[model samples]
Target: MKRDKISVVGFMGSGKTTIGLLLANFLNYFFYDLDEYIEKKEGKSIKDIFADYGEEHFRNLESFYLKELIEKHNKIVISTGGGIIKREINRKLLKEKTFVVFLDGSFEVFMNRLEGTEEKDKRPLMSLGKDELYNLWISRKPLYEEVATLKINVDSKTPYQIVREILDFYGKM
Candidate 1:
């Protein structure tokens, strides 16, 4: 099916935001990072939201924001939060409204990219150690795959290369 918009989804550190920006520029579409949108709407940092309201509350807000965004935007590329696919409704909305791409990356690569980052406190999920992170990856991988129209492995690729891959996959190149 043809789509007017694109939505990029992936685990944390998978370059969804970075590659989404480049892809949106190439496609000349507006770019929306859902997490950043939520942060703006809530008037608080994601870290603060997680600390104050907890993950469930934050997720509820995320769902609300995503629905509003999809309802109101077109010809845009949206980068969704890693856990966005956890909800079936979000998955259906994304599938109906946009071309969904899963940017897949290995856990080691993700850890390497995320290492020493100050954003850890803001991302409660990343507070886990290596083993727990791996477990999280294992559990979430299937959900990411299940909802994606296209899956691009980003293990060793640059953001630009990933954008190229996405364009190729979407037959837009």
Candidate 2:
């Protein structure tokens, strides 16, 4: 329960990077957006990765980098890509190694958060259409639940409120 590494997992628009940055700043810990890290490591956008290689290759890179970060860092906050949970090994690693926070929110809420945002276009799976993405959420919801150490409903809460809630829980544990 007292994990130093906190990994935030959720749908694409679930504020993982934003909240993870705040949480890490508040705690004076290292913050890594896994996607950004991947982009830097591979020298290309994730969309390019998907287009050049494939989702399978991307997932492999995601999993490999995830493990590298987990093993190398202790006091850290990780904002994971939405599809990281698609792999069983990634799920197990997160569940066992980090204080995994599943930022729970409805599909509509997530879509609204991301709507009209330029960054939305950068996501490979965004091309799959709303219905498919919603189904992806449906299928992955339980996987997030299964790996979460603390599940935070992000629908109605402000970012500050969510951070406070996580800090409060961290303090208790």
TM-score of model number 1: 0.94
Look at candidate 1 and give me any clashing residue pairs: none
- Residues 49-160 of candidate 2: C-alpha lDDT, one tens digit per residue: 9999999999999999999999999899999999999999999999999999999999999999888999888998988888999999999999999999999999999999
TM-score of each: 0.94, 0.98
Check candidate 2 and list the clashing pairs: none
Quick one: best TM-score, which candidate?
Answer: 2
**All predictions: root-mean-square deviation over Cα?**
1.5, 0.7
Off by over 4 Å in 2: none
In the range 1-173, model 1's lDDT, one tens digit per residue, is 64768899988988888989999999899999998999999999887898899988988998899989888988889999988988888888888778899999888888788778775556778877879878888888998888788999999888888888888878852
Q: Give the poorly placed runs of model 1, Cα more than 4 Å off.
A: none
